[model samples]
Target: MKRRPRRTIPATLTALVLLAACVLVAIVAIQLAIGRTPIISYRSVTGTLHSIHWNDTAPLIAGGTCALLGLLLLLAALLPGRPTVLPLTGDMDAGVTRRSLRHALQNTAATVDGVTRAKLKLGRRTIVARIRTDRTNTAGLTDAVRGALDQRLDQVAPLNRPAMKIQLRATRNAP
Candidate 1:
């Protein structure tokens, strides 16, 4: 049986978030159990009752905030950087190969009419292309892109009939 590839970022982030939430809850519970009050101690600078208070609530709040922030950061790191392209899955060693295939697919898609840019994602068994096109002719441009990719890159087995997403944006003036 073939072994499946593993990508841990998503799982790790989820675990981190869960763990942080648990820790925050535990801290809050502990503070509550301790009566949620500051302990004050008195010392003398010049034979006076100058007091110092150890605030258990402050520590609990601070710990909870830090844990929550850490969880948020982990989640943010795990999220995809932008929504410009499709999502892909593959082994670590296939990065370059996948990137090259993606570039080729993008190039092919960009050749279609009204397409301003193309972003491609190549997975282990499938490929997806996202095309940015002018709003006026997006459907036509998408159809043309699909046709062109099907004709030009059919030799690439995994990507022969890739799924295509066309996003219509304002046409930019060429400089």
Candidate 2:
């Protein structure tokens, strides 16, 4: 099962907008209590609201814009994000990061005999291991790498284990 991401971005933006509105209201109220002219003129705003009828184009446009913005924010908050970690199978709840799991697989393949370097890509359907070997004849190197990786995977025991693929590149010995 995939993990759900936290709605940090949407939540933070909404909180900041609400905070700014609250601060503006509080500042206006404080100015009014001290009998000072507010930074925003209340009389002008009241007159503008009174003048804007329901059928006015300006009001309709402003209301439509606000509704669209609200819907966008709601969708952003509700949508799910990509899972960062792959789930591991165990008695307890456990998971491994994608980077770490890929690194572990590469390291396992590299530990095999005659393998000089190893790079691995883990995807939804396949885990591809690209290895560079010093040995000229790579007859059984593929199986060896596959066996080593399978053993390591058995230890890790992930819920979704993909099929493995090996690509070999051998460097001929220089005289």
Candidate 3:
């Protein structure tokens, strides 16, 4: 069965709008406490009891707000989301989350000599690592990162062996 993406944002927005509507209703209802007629009247300018009266600008503003909300909800429903986990190779349905894979790759890259920090971006077809190192010779760092990542990939054995790209950066204050 396919899983539905959580409607966190939309749900929150809906709750907030409903709360605002309730507040407006309460404000109108409060006229009872003071024994005064409500600001929103049922009698029109012609004084007919069956007709309703409303400020002209208020309805337009409320309609526009509702329209904007509907548009946002539609966009949220239609947009595709990135999955959290990527399936790995094997007869079993094993998988690793992107966060875990990125963490592992970053740690692996950081083990290279002179490397102070590492960041990794994992995709279906590519694994890119950006490394910051103390050494001016980035050629060696690139080779080391590639080899380490290859060994890590072999161990994990993901469904696809994505091509690795290394970006080496020199730290300004490195000794």
Candidate 2 matches the true fold with a TM-score of: 0.64
- For residues 34-108, could you state the per-residue lDDT of candidate 2 as single tens digits? 999998889999999998899999989999999998998889877766566888897778888878889999989
lDDT per residue (tens digit) for residues 1-175 in model 1: 1223343565676688899978876776676678874222112322332242335666578779989977876766665442222233333322224456677777888887677777777654455776775555344665677787887555454412455554445565344
lDDT per residue (tens digit) for residues 69-128 in model 3: 899898887886565677788898878877898899889889877789999998757988
- Model 3 segments more than 4 A misplaced: 1-5, 30-65, 123-125, 172-175
Query: Could you give the candidate ranking by TM-score, starting with the highest?
Result: 3, 2, 1
Candidate 3's displacement at residue 88, Å, is: 1.8
Q: What is the lDDT of residue 135 in candidate 2?
A: 88
Worst 10 residues of 1 by lDDT: 38-47
lDDT winner: 2
- Between candidates 1 and 3, the one scoring higher on lDDT is 3
